[model samples]
Each structure stands twice: as structure tokens, then as C-alpha cells.
Target: MSHSVAEHEPAEVTESGNANGAGIDLKWLSDRVEYGLYQDCVHCGLCTASCPTYVMTGDENDSPRGRIYLMRAVVDGRASVTEKVRHHLGLCLDCRACETACPSGVQYGKLIEPFKVALEISADGDDRPPLLLRILLRHLFPYANRMKWALIPARIGMKTGLIPIARSLGLTKLLPKTLQRMEEMLPPSMPLLPPAPLPEKLEPVGKKRATVALFTGCVTDAMTPETNSATARILQHNGCEVHVVAGQACCGAVSYHSGDENGAKAFMRANLNAFDLSKYDAVIINAAGCGAMLKDYAHLMHHDPEAARAAAFTAKVKDITEFLVELGPVKPANRVEAKLTYHDACHLCHGQQIRNQPRQLLGMIEGLSIVPLEETEICCGAAGTYNLSQPEMSRRLGRRKAEYIDATGASVVAVANIGCQMQIRYYLDERGGSHEVVHPVELLDRAYGPLPGGTA
Candidate 1:
């Protein structure tokens, strides 16, 4: 839990054992920071082709390869954590699409996380929000009970017409646009029911073929419980016993992305204690952000001896699409008839290196034609709180994303993350068009039968 500045070392390039044929040799001090990871880069610019920020800003500094160069410079003591460096680094979506395209298989996400941590330590001024905002974001948002208490007031204000009145009076425009979007994106107040705790193990409904544990993430539980219920139903119908653990909280992705290492670690430990990993064939994370985080537990717990055991447990964690794909074909029901477009959540596609599973799963559903959206791999600018913190850029990205979705002429936009869903929903609403932004599981759920609380 103790964070300290990294010790400075003499300027010298360190070489990795495999760097002889791998290209560049990393320096010794750089090795401790895993600067060797960048040595594998051939600078072929393949990463630039897939980089969302690069596509958006057309700036080399905003590209993945460019950021790696900046990181390499810092590692070699050739660069300082200056404002320009920090700005370029901060602009990265950390979407990890670059890794998918890199033939060298550079570990971009892992490399960037440490670089961010080091940057935060080296930076001069505090980049974090006000004290109260920081406390609320770090503590309350990640905790279920506290989040419910906070949502209550927001929900009450929205239901009482205060939010609409304020907007009409031009009061909300005075507030930050991110706050305005948050107000507009609020779904109708739904009942906040506790997650259903499943038995340690479950026998598959029909053939008892596979057993899976579902990690119904924090926001999904409170904001979109239908996704969780639908996931459970779909899995169960497909001869899988679904175990839903109640104690699982946020995947710590939000805090980790914001440089709140302590908050992230605490949530990581709590999640580790919440489930028994060996019991299920695979840990199913429906939310793309949480899915990506679960897969990286080993790297996150690399420094903690006590949490290492739990980290190993996380090695088996799988996104729902990945898990379902591994289970082979499910008997297709001829119920899904809607034409839809699939928006790849950055975490699922790039972060976790899962690109085909969702598409494959969608293909299995009968009567559903998958129309490809333009720039499907680009970030929707909902990188955790990136939309809230950098509203202008977020809005720009969201509008671009909306245009792509609109071009497809699809009635439904299916995505895997709650944040992306909310952001996309906001853009669609602003355009004065009618299109439902839904989770892929919700679409699948509709294929199986009517959802628990009726179809939306």
C-alpha cells in the first residue's frame, strides 16, 4: 500500500536475454520497469493503423508506438515526466488494440499501467479531482451499498422532474457537460435487488455439461440487472449451471485507470475473497472492462505475495463470449430476428485480446445479421471516467461512434460494457433518433424467452 518515488539509476541501456534477435536492447534501470517490452517493437507502424486516438487526432504522439517511444525515453533517462509527455500519455485510451495488431506481441497494457503509476509519482501538481469528488469516486462508486445511497438522490431528482426543468432552464449547461450527460443518461429508476447467491456448485439443467460462475459487475448489478439475469438464463438454458456470487464488487478497473492504486488493490482483494475459483469451469465476466481486469490479475498482484494465490485463480477468468465459444455450439433457437450492429468494447476486443468470440456467439443466434460498424475497434471515449474527466474529447469520440452506428441503419446497438452503453445511449438520444443500446446478453436473452422483468 505504500507508494514511493522510484530510485534513479545511471544512464545505460539494458539488454533482455532475447533482445539479441528481438531488436533493441533495454537498459538496466529500464529492465526493472520492463522497458525491455518495447525493445521488441519493430516500429512497423502496424499499431498506428489500429490506434483509436491516432485515427481521431492524427498525431503520432497519441499513437501507441509513439507512447511506447516516450516511455522508452523515460526509462532510459533521456526524458523527464514533463507536461507535454504527461498530456500525450494521458490521452491514450489504453484500449490495447495496438497489441492485437503487433506481430511482436508487445505487452502494451501492462507497460502503460506502470508508466502511469510512475508519472503520477513524478508529476508536480495534483491532477486528481477535488477532495470530495476523489473520495466519492474512489470509495462510494466501488462499494455497492454506498452507490445505492448516492443513486437514490440522483434518481429522486430525475423522477421529480428537477433534472428536465434544470435542463430546460439552461441551468445544466452551466455545469460541466459531463455532468449534464450523466443526468441525461440516467435510466428509469429500477428496483435495486440484491444479487442472487448461488450454491457453491450447480448441476447443468439438461445434460449437466458445463458449470460457470458469473461475475455480475458492480454497475451492471445496480444499473442493468437485466443483463445479469439474462446471462444466467442463457447459460442455464444451454446446459450450464450458473453460480452468481453476491460479494463480488467492482473489478477495480475504474480506480486503476485513474491512478488510484490503493483503491484498485482493495477491490481486487475483495473480489479474490468473493469466489472459489476451482469450482467453476470458467469465471464469466459479462462486462468487458471487468473481464479485461479479471484476466490481468496476475500482473496486478505481481508485487503482493499474499494475493498471488488469488491472482492465479484469476487466470481462469473468461469473458462470457469466450466461455460460450469454448463450450462449442449451442442449439440455435429460431427466435432472434432483429438486425443489429455490434460495438466492440475496448476491454473485450483489445484489453483481453478477445475479438472473435462475441461475433461468433452473435452468429449462432438465428436470424441475426451482423452488420459491421465503421471504426468498430475505436474507443467510444468511455474509458472508465474518461468521458467525465475529458468531456470534449469524449463527446467528439462519441459523436463519431454514433455516426458509424447510424450508418449501419441497425435498430439495436449491442455492446459489452455498461459505460460504453450509457455513452452511446446519450449520443443516440441527442441525435433525436430511436435506437436501443443493449448488451449482447440482452439480445440473447430475448432469443431464449421473455426477460425476467418483461422485454424492454
Candidate 2:
């Protein structure tokens, strides 16, 4: 791709992007992104194969190196933030697979993350996110209680079999596109029963090996409450005391990624205040996205007054699998009795470099045989809300994932992230597959014993 911006309009926007200072000043990118980070990319094309968007479109503009070049062009006054330029950047999954593929140790997430935020902030009215999506991201997703209450009607419909009937009759078409996608992603099973409320504290089942706090993520806890319950139990089963802070909130990824930089920082600060890092051996997060965001707190707040505290907090943040493996998991004795393939959540595998841990944890279970999945590390096109925003690319990638899952011939598909689980399950359902999509811990929990309400 040419580094020169597409010639449509002159680069008229100043540093403030507008007279009243609404959009980002392209010239000031050095203030937002460390100049060295962009220089780290050698444009080697090695990351192309790993980038989902480039793999799909074969457009260099969608690749990390190309995007880096685009950013450089815009920053150096050689290019304008044209609509076409924005579209290419918007299409990126931000899966950070390129970071895994890059030999130069470039922090791709750091570059793309803040750059996207700046790009969104500068977006003209025509290019801004739709109003409905803005409300959902700003209001609904960050609040656990609000999301739980909001899903009640859908839960009722699912319970009464009305949802399926509505879906079959095309009645769901009346809902907003985002809502329609949510409905489609909802598991086919009737009304999602709320999981048992985890106590603020749970003592270790055998002996107190460590004390840790659990991060009950906003949407993850509200949507799949059982995952959180199971996570707590598994921690307890392995001799760790778990604590849940009542005041804990979202990990701020939704807002941050959506270009609400202040909103993301606010959420991060709330979490920073909510957890006392000194008291716990680690702060455990079950969702991969949440874990990735929690782990980024120190970097996100590097220059803020809470820098010291945020650094302290981030050091203790660990994905449940990462924590368990480091603590030396107690071997699970019971049999799960299933053939399974694991799809690595991009953040868990690429962002956190946690490839072997979840698989190792699963390997400990009896009667569970793991199968290799083709392109298992590829994104399922559910990088948070990408499925709703970029439906075309999302659909293509989701279908691709479903095809791979089908080829596995496994009865179960184990995933670490809720987004991956929901996206894969929805696509698999579309392909008429009945495979079970579950968190790795859910399998471990089953091996330990039936969950709180007893398994189906």
C-alpha cells in the first residue's frame, strides 16, 4: 500500500483537528504514541500472515506494518485522515497476533490502541460510531447490575421458547442491528439461569495456599455467571482463598478500545481503588479480555499520580490459568470424558503470551483427550464488539472459525474468553453443529464435581 494518503481532500485539519479542538491534531502523534514504538516495525511483511484482516483482504493497508506507515504518513503531513484511511484502520481486529509474529519485539497493542483512540476522537460526525452503539458502550456494558437487569426480558423470551419462535418468524429483525447480533449470539439453551452468587470470601477447600481476589468482569459475570462461580470454586479446590470486591467494575477495555480514553481511564482508576494489591497474592481475572486490560493498568496510567499504585496492582493481575499453573495446580482426579480442541483467545495467547498454561491445566484432567485445531491461535473475529461493528469481516472470520471447529470432530470446543465462546458458538450453531463451547475451567470444575446447581 502507498504511504501517501488517498487524494480526496487536502490535509486541512490542524493539530486540534478542528477550530474548536474536537479531533486529534495529527502532528501531535508523538505526544500520544512513543515515536520509538512505530520505528520498531521494520515493514518486514512477516506479520502479514498473522494479521486476520490482511489475511482476509490481502490488503497491505490492513496489515500492522501498513497501518504503521499510514500513521507515519499522517503524522508527517504527507497524508490526510481520509475516510478510506479510517476504514482500513477500523477493519483491524487489534488481535495483536502481529506482536506474536514480529521478531523485533514491537508492542503493537500500544501503538494501535492509543492511535485508534486518537483516530476516533478526531473522526468527523459522518465517521463517528452510531449513536446506539455509543450508548450501549458508554452505559450498558460497563455496569454489571444494569446489564443483568437489561437481559431479563431476553431471558424470559428464551425461557418461554418465544425467542426461538420470534427468530424463526423473522420477528427479531425489528430490533436494532446490535441487539439482533446479541440475540443471535445468545446460547440456544433456554433462559440463562443466573449462577450462584460467589461469596465475598471463600476459604480454601483443603489448605490455604494463597489468598487472591477475583475480578468479576461486567458483561462476563452478568452473561455467564457460572463461569465466575466455577472459577472461584476451582481456585478454592486448589487451596486458594478467593475474595470478590463488591465495588469492582469493568476492566475499561470496552471504553478504551472504543476511543473513550477518559472513560477507560476512569474505569481503570475505579478498579485500582477497588482492589488492595498488597493484601492478595494475585488478582485473578477469568475473562481473557479483562485480564489483558487489567494487566495493562500500569502502562495505561504510567504518567498519572496513581502510577505507583497502578504498577503495584498490575504486577498482581493474572489470568486464572496463568495463576493456577504458577501456583502448581492440584491434579484433577475425576474424568470429563470428552474429545476437545482448544481455540486460543487472542488476548490470552498473543496479548498475554499464555499458550501452554490453559492447555496444561486441561491436560491434568482424566479422560480428556485434546485434539489439535488448525489455526487455533487465529482470532474468531470476536475481538470484543468487532462482530457488531464490522459485520462483514466478522462474519467471514466467524465462518472460518466454525469450519475449523467442524473439521476437528470434537464434541467440545474449549475457549478462554467469553467473547470467543459466544462468537464461536453462534457461528457453529449457524453451521448446524451441536458442539459444546465452554471455558477450560468449566471442564475442570466438572471434573472436581458437579457445579453448584448440578450439571446437565
> Residue 288 error for model 1, in Å?
0.8
TM-score of each: 0.86, 0.93
lDDT of 2 by residue, 231-307 (tens): 98899888888998878889999998888888998998888889987789999998998899999989888888999
Clashing pairs in 2: 15-25
- Give the number of the best model, judged by TM-score: 2
Counting clashing residue pairs in each candidate, in order, gives: 4, 1
* Residue pairs of candidate 1 with colliding backbone atoms: 13-27, 14-26, 14-27, 14-28
Task: Report the C-alpha lDDT of model 1 over 313-364, residue by residue, as the tens digit.
Answer: 6777988878888887575565787779999999888887777888887877
